[model samples]
Target chain A: MDPLFEKGMTELNRPPTDRPFQAFEIVFWHVLDEMFEERLLPGDVLYETALSQELGLSRTPVREALSRLVAEGLLENPAGTRGYRVPDLSADDLQQVFQAREILESSAAALAAEHARKGDIGELEEIHRREILFSSQENRREYCRANVEFHFAVMRIGGNRYLERAFRPVFWRSQLYVNYLAEFHPLNGEELTAESGHNSPAEHAALIRAIARRAPKAAAKAAAEHLRSTTAYRILLDTERARHIFGGSSR
Target chain B: MDPLFEKGMTELNRPPTDRPFQAFEIVFWHVLDEMFEERLLPGDVLYETALSQELGLSRTPVREALSRLVAEGLLENPAGTRGYRVPDLSADDLQQVFQAREILESSAAALAAEHARKGDIGELEEIHRREILFSSQENRREYCRANVEFHFAVMRIGGNRYLERAFRPVFWRSQLYVNYLAEFHPLNGEELTAESGHNSPAEHAALIRAIARRAPKAAAKAAAEHLRSTTAYRILLDTERARHIFGGSSR
Candidate 1:
């Protein structure tokens, strides 16, 4: 069993009434956290029995959590496979994921610009503020979390629950690639410099400004350009660097 | 009990080994078919126990089917509510769904233009051919299904499973509206004539031609324009007509 499972066992063993969380929700977040932290790498196979036994829980909730993760595209049960594995996204997969993100998030930004309230703008600003702080302090994990929060906040401001729901899985799948990028090219490293076309913080600021000003076209353009730059950065990494980031898990 | 439940019970009674279908999958399709056929109208609630009893199956599969439908946005388990209800989409909801469809399907068209092989183009042409046939024959349900197949074929040709997955639920939700529109305005009626701007068969042909010629920009523009025209036709349906179509179920 992976050591990461042990890390969350104490919390999982708590009395049911002690917290409002369900067994499957607890397990889901635990595994998701492990993936985001890189403690669970791509190609890591997660067996239901092993996970349930490690957590001292029944196989039911364990299965539910794994199945949900698989449905969300964060994990995959390959054809004829039993256990779920953290997906080893290839370059083509990365391209497709980014392309989907560009479409969804740009439209989300446009909607946010048209529909966002003052309170919504404040919420977005707060998330972006924390994102900048996390970047400045070199907190990679929190930075990733805050970055995700910023995009999700914009989605919420879009005032379309369906759009937000559709964006959720695609956003999380792309985050896996973002997390990998963060691991190889640190937050403040030279690779993310303006010349590398990966200046997300600055790009995020521009997006927020457009939304705050209620400029729908500008917001959409800003969001698309930001994603395009990110895609360009990913492409520039080259196959050799991608191999390093994926840790020999590229399929 | 809904009479539609009785319609599929005969098929559901087959022995487990007779077919490879799961109980939950059968239930899922049965419910989905009812929704698409408009036998299950907006604001109709579906309970697990009731569905299980009607289908002569256990609550487990019934619950699974309903939950999957809820997750897919076909049905909604409203907050503080117990059973799933066919969603009562408002005009804003319709707008949001169309916006999402435009973004996803247009991108899918562009990607298909770039990546589609001859076989994929042939597949799309076949679906469009059926769509026109059904349209001329005044077959609403088959026309709708072929229309869906046409778009899905484009998504498949895009070579991005992720994009197709993201588009599925949104497309289905939009189909509900399309079905409602069809109920109020027949396929060959004046409301869908050239002046009313609801010419799907012609638009589909244009999209296919663009894809066949490998014109990515033209394909994307055709897709976007097609959805925009559909949205326009939806808006043209006054609130009174919408109420009649939804059977006073609009929320």
Candidate 2:
């Protein structure tokens, strides 16, 4: 077993006091987090029996959740096979995912600017503050979670449930990219932390300000720019890594 | 026993020389069409065994397809039960669905404007011309199908597979609204036909022109306006129906 999987298992073992999600949902998201963090790499076999036993869950819900992931195209459903494998994320797939964010998140921000109440705006500010604090502490996971929370808050502020639902799978898959950076990139953990520490907070603050001012076009532009910045950073890192490997020009 | 279900059955019964979709996929989309057309309204039970028997398919594939739809939130899985139910589309649900269209389709149009090839432009023109011809013939179904095809063609032209995938379920659900107008609205078929004949072709022509000119902003704006126009028409019909029901001044 990979050490990353062991760390995930340890985290899963620590019971949450609140426990809002169902058993199946808990395992479902845990496995997804593993995949996002690159703890579960492409072609990593997910054994149903081991996962169920380890999570203290029954086999049925575990199978059900895996089936859902398989349908979402994140995991491959090998015919007549008992286990699932993580599907490889190609460059084209990553590009399309971010392109979708440019469209969906920009629209979401514009709607948020138009429709967000004072309370909604306050919630975004609160999340931004939490993100800032987390960045200072170098708590990557909590910072990432706070970022997701801020985006979802904006999704609700948009006042469109269908937009929320339609954009959701795309958003979760995009989160994988952030986790990919935090875990798999050639940069050390400290460098990764320092990179997000320097970049994410300012972008988030600008996003909140745009929403607060009710500037729909500005909000939309801010949201798209924020996503593009992350993509740009990741691509730059990938290019650097490639240059290091192949002895070629950075471009 | 419903007439709409019978029509869906006939369509599904026809043997195909070039069957591109799997049996499960065929059944999944067929059921969606039935739901959108109101052949399977709220509270209608979807029995896997009966569906399998009627469609000349096995239980396993039908079950798998229903599971997929259930995940998509079109079907409510009854606890401790074998079948599914169609959920009612609330007014809020309808509003959100169209709002999603405004975001997604606009983004798709912008991308299409940026990336569309000459062949893509020609294909869109071909669809537009066909739509014009269909409007003159007052063939509602063909016209609606062609409009869907045109939009999907633009999605393909956008060159973002994830965007295409994200837009798909929403697009399918949006088609439900068009079919809802045909089936359940107060207007007769002739009136609906007349309405689309007057409105849709002009909007579609404008959209084609924007894309052909490679004007991303114009294309996005046009696509969003076209969707809002449809929503406006539907809301007008709904208001009229409400007035007829409650004996009050139309709000």
Candidate 3:
């Protein structure tokens, strides 16, 4: 029989422990929660020994878990080293990731429009509706979670397993930047207003409409531009934060 | 002291391994080679125990390596108990990857045009020149190798590691399909003729010119269109091949 857990698709009835997934998978997610949840930052070192001791697990599983994070591009392990850490991206790196995400995500959205089932469109409408709900209430965390799901939902509809699988890791790996940016970018009406003044929820609404109508070209354009707006503002935020935190001389 | 390598940079000397790299890393690449060079299908089983004995290593590294591949989307490990296998793509899955690549690569090319440095442009031109040599000489392997490098040359000049890193694995991963297509595509003059009908050489030259001129929009358009052309053509070829190999009933 095929293994239960495919990527991002939850496994409700999976056995407690299995060959491919070690206990470290669970333990690793807990540690990753600190990073993906934004309680950690790049440049933070992960002491394998310490984590192994704390979790009461062997070094092997801890090591394996860390390897998974490194593969996800969230952590960097150099030269078969004992300790691992996150990569601290500069403005250049941020631009790079955002630009890539913008283009790739847009393309995914467009393709999704071509193959989208009625149910797929319905799911996206629901996600967008809930996004608006979370946005008005200013629930940043919930907004972040929903935002990821919405994008992934688009990927799911796009019918490209290869692309979906590749892109999702990138999405997870980028949590640091995404989470940090979200701190200043709240989900409230005022925050959305200031942010969306450039493109606003209207752009996303347009995207949803395009998908609903199954217009590939329009959907693609909407998605790409939406991503571009977010990245462009992300660069500005990074610049402003750097100046505020590190001073002009540092920059 | 970074053990990880980067593109187009001269390597600082380090002691070579007495054996190969880690067993799992070696096996991962070996399997990836099948994806790239040998046409390992999407759902092909990659067994740890068998490969471990072959490599004269324990299953530990092999298992860890499989996890890394799973994260990369090349191999999927089902959630519960089972061995790891490279997952097959539905037509939708393949479409998503190329679509994403099309957008990102196009944008990168456009950006390369706008921001590519003189030296970087020179380097890309150099790579293109090599492609001419490989193409005319009828060395299929060399031509394909040169082709990948030439595209990478654009990415390098684009100066976005994040974009390059994200685009390449997914792009190369499609070699799984290309490898099969090449079986029918053959290295004959007909194949070469089909390939050469496009002024890719001229497009490369034009892209370099745009980069030198720092025309970002032009570069982006050229790059995006270039990818779309390739993706569309490849899909056509895939359809034709499926019809031929599996009979018309397959489609």
Candidate 4:
């Protein structure tokens, strides 16, 4: 294979232009969405040759998109080689990712809940309502988007840029689990009543209440508990599924 | 002038190879350290031409190191940029860095107080002793290093890999504060009459006792209070110093 094909991260040195940046960001965002959607996995290579041809752009823009994707933790270029590939999902990684997410994002949610914007709680309430509706209807795509929106909104309101920056990679890394969440619609608490049952509606409702009440401790606890019950464990269950869907990762 | 000097992130294609990766990493680590030392600053462009000449290698490894540095949050190659440069750090950036450190590392210190390793506590005791000696004699650099070691050891014993990683960059980004702590080092209990006094040796001793006694709450309080005092006026000092050291950023 070509050296660039072998190493995924090194390509970031290429000079970029403004016109290419718009296309690059647009493509990368789309690719990242696909990465989380489970359409892209760890080992499968993103072929610049094919993408440039398909996207009707030069390899420059496509490669630019690839670099940003790599930076975002959606892809990796292993030490010895180049060209980007999906980072393989692993059980340990899943746990670490969630553990970090639990520590950081939970605090973010708590802070957001406490220091939330005037209408933020109302907006989150709407998100919760929409997520539950989408999940009930088994609309995986919409649910995933809403799930991301809800959490991201909370992080923004968390009022701590460092926490947000530090936790970002882990959040992106957990997209594999998000893909799994989409498929199984895991334990949308409307039905069975087990500890693992993640009732999206109820969780969202509680989250809004916690935030509305200006409750950091409650918001933090609720966020951690919600993640612990729903997203965290669900990632564990989907370990093999990730390998099956995205192949294996070298890292 | 070059495209790599632009305002956002974009991917670049890299042809790579299977190499030891050690040389670049060693260099990269030093490069990052120098960045923290303020040897590198925002808008100071990376010269691929010059670095390759000095390293006596092709652009491959040099560019690769630069790419990873960008990923490490020390450098930025904005969209349409052909070069990498250290990111500008504002007071808000510095404050965010410290605030999250206050939350996360304090929690880690508290947690470490619960299940601290025997060797860890012993080592911490020695660290405090050194700080006492250093403060007595005023050994600035050694005291600063000891300060980092003490905090990092506490975080390590916390046994939370996730938290450890999250805490690292924050600590690193605040090295300037560590250096400045030398000037702020309070003499003793008498000097620490106010909240913002450094008396770090005493604080560290208290922290050790808390951890030794497995008092999580006390350990956290000690740790948080120590940093709160040590860095309390750092923001104001930095703002005042900004014009001289960072006139371009003195907005």
What does candidate 1's lDDT look like per residue over A82-141, in tens digits? 889888756767777887888888988998999999898889888888878877887655
The global Cα lDDT (0 to 1) of model 2 is: 0.70
Candidate 3 vs candidate 4: the TM-score winner is: 3
User: Model 3, A198-251: lDDT tens per residue?
Assistant: 343567789888888889899989987777666334444557554442211111
Candidate 4 stretches greater than 4 Å from native: A1-95, A177-198, A234-251, B1-23, B54-56, B176-198, B232-234, B237-251
TM-score of 1: 0.83
lDDT of 2 by residue, A44-157 (tens): 789889999988889867876787787666677666466887765555566788888778888889999999899998899898898889878877667766777777778779
- lDDT (Cα, tens digit) per residue for candidate 1, span B1-251: 24544343222222235345667767987887777667887888899999999889998778767777777888887555788988885666777788788888998899999998999888988888888887888776566567667777788898887888898888878877766655554343655632223278899999999999999999999999888787334554455555445444533
Candidates in order: C-alpha RMSD to true structure: 5.9, 6.1, 6.5, 8.6
Instruction: Give the candidates in order of DockQ, highest first.
Output: 2, 3, 1, 4
State which docking tier applies to candidate 1: acceptable
What's model 1's lDDT at A105? Answer: 87
In order of TM-score, best first, we have 1, 2, 3, 4
Using DockQ as the measure, which candidate wins? 2
Full ranking by lDDT: 1, 2, 4, 3
Residue B130 in model 1: lDDT = 87
By summed lDDT, which 10 consecutive residues of candidate 1 chain B come out lowest? B7-16
Worst 10 residues of 3 chain A by lDDT: A242-251
Error of 1 at B36 (Å): 1.3
Q: Lowest-scoring 10 consecutive residues by lDDT in candidate 1 chain A?
A: A7-16
Q: lDDT tens digits, residues B1-251, model 2?
A: 22432443224323343545567766776787667566776557889999999888997668768888877767877555667876555555666777787778888899899998899999998988888887778776667667777778888888887777777767766665555544555564545532343487799889889999999999999998887677334654476563332221121
Which 10-residue window of candidate 3 chain B scores lowest in summed lDDT? B6-15
What are the chain A TM-scores of the candidates, in order?
Answer: 0.81, 0.78, 0.79, 0.76
